[model samples]
Target: MNTSSKQDERIARMTFASVYPHYLAKIEKKGRTEAELHQVIEWLTGFDAPKLQQLIEDKVTFESFFREAIINKNVHLITGVICGYRVEEITNPLTQQVRYLDKLVDELAKGKKMEKILRSSL
Candidate 1:
């Protein structure tokens, strides 16, 4: 692969790795149920982490893996990054609440609204 492609891949992997734990901590601090948090952890550290790592190792562009994650119901992985949510809660709380991509999209569409909801709850 070209240099830029390799760099994008590395960035993608590093981004996920760097941000995932932060997401988890937020979820825990938010008082998400233990069962919910566990689910998020399973998805983030299990399938999501390994898949992202492999995509980087295979020299896939960040955009490619990002798109695939959405197509495959792994959009939470990306959403957590953008919304500053706990990665661990992505799969647990939000994952369960979101039953479809459209639903996730809608919630994300109301980004500021969601932020308000989260903030008010706190």
Candidate 2:
């Protein structure tokens, strides 16, 4: 598989719940709260705390999470370096969306204000 498809396959089989602990650990290590992480995720995916927890309990994959998500309308305004790639310039749609979430969580861990992290008060 080419790079994009190969990446898709890898992430597609990865479960969101499986990554939850790592996310919590990363932010906690940086002195941030799990609730803030949840807020960032909810903002990006349009999944409330309860629904997010439900999906997590179900062990949904990254592919399934993004597929079922309603990505925010303000997503276009989220532009920044993430894993060395500019979010807006990412060539693959699914990869771009996934990286967007990763970038958001990274920002939260770095203590960026939520207003700026969400890109606006939309």
Candidate 3:
């Protein structure tokens, strides 16, 4: 490989070495076997690790990383010493709940305004 590619490979290797343990911990907690974890790690090491390391070394922020790594893709396999699969299937229900609450507050504010107007008229 070329110099840039070799540097990329080294960064990928280092990143994978750093993140694999965390990934294994998460998967083990979910009752997955070591063999399954290895499979997941292999898949992540295939592409994600190198790309992620490049991004990190490029100093990409967490928000951008999450957006690119998880939001843009339905499935992401992230590996390192912190290996694991990141399924972007989880919804942030709380965001919708907060929006609804905000609308409710607006309606309540309107009601208070009407009450104040009626009281002044009386």
- What tens-digit string does per-residue lDDT give for candidate 3 at 1-122? 12244433343334333444555565566555545544332232232545745764766433333335322121222111111211122123222222222222332333334222222223
Q: Best TM-score goes to which candidate?
A: 2
For each candidate, give its TM-score against the true structure. 0.30, 0.90, 0.27
* TM-score winner, 1 or 3: 1
Lowest summed lDDT across 10 adjacent residues in model 3 is found at 78-87
**RMSD to truth, every model:** 11.9, 2.3, 21.0
State the lDDT of candidate 2 residue by residue for 1-122, as single tens digits.
Answer: 02367776886788999988988899999999989998999889999999999999999999899999999989998888887778888877777888888889888899999998988854
Ordering by lDDT: 2, 1, 3
User: Which ranges of candidate 2 are over 4 A from the true structure?
Assistant: 1-3
Kindly report the root-mean-square deviation of model 2 from the true structure over all alpha carbons: 2.3
Give lDDT per model, in order. 0.39, 0.86, 0.34
lDDT of 3 at 39: 33
lDDT computed for candidate 3: 0.34
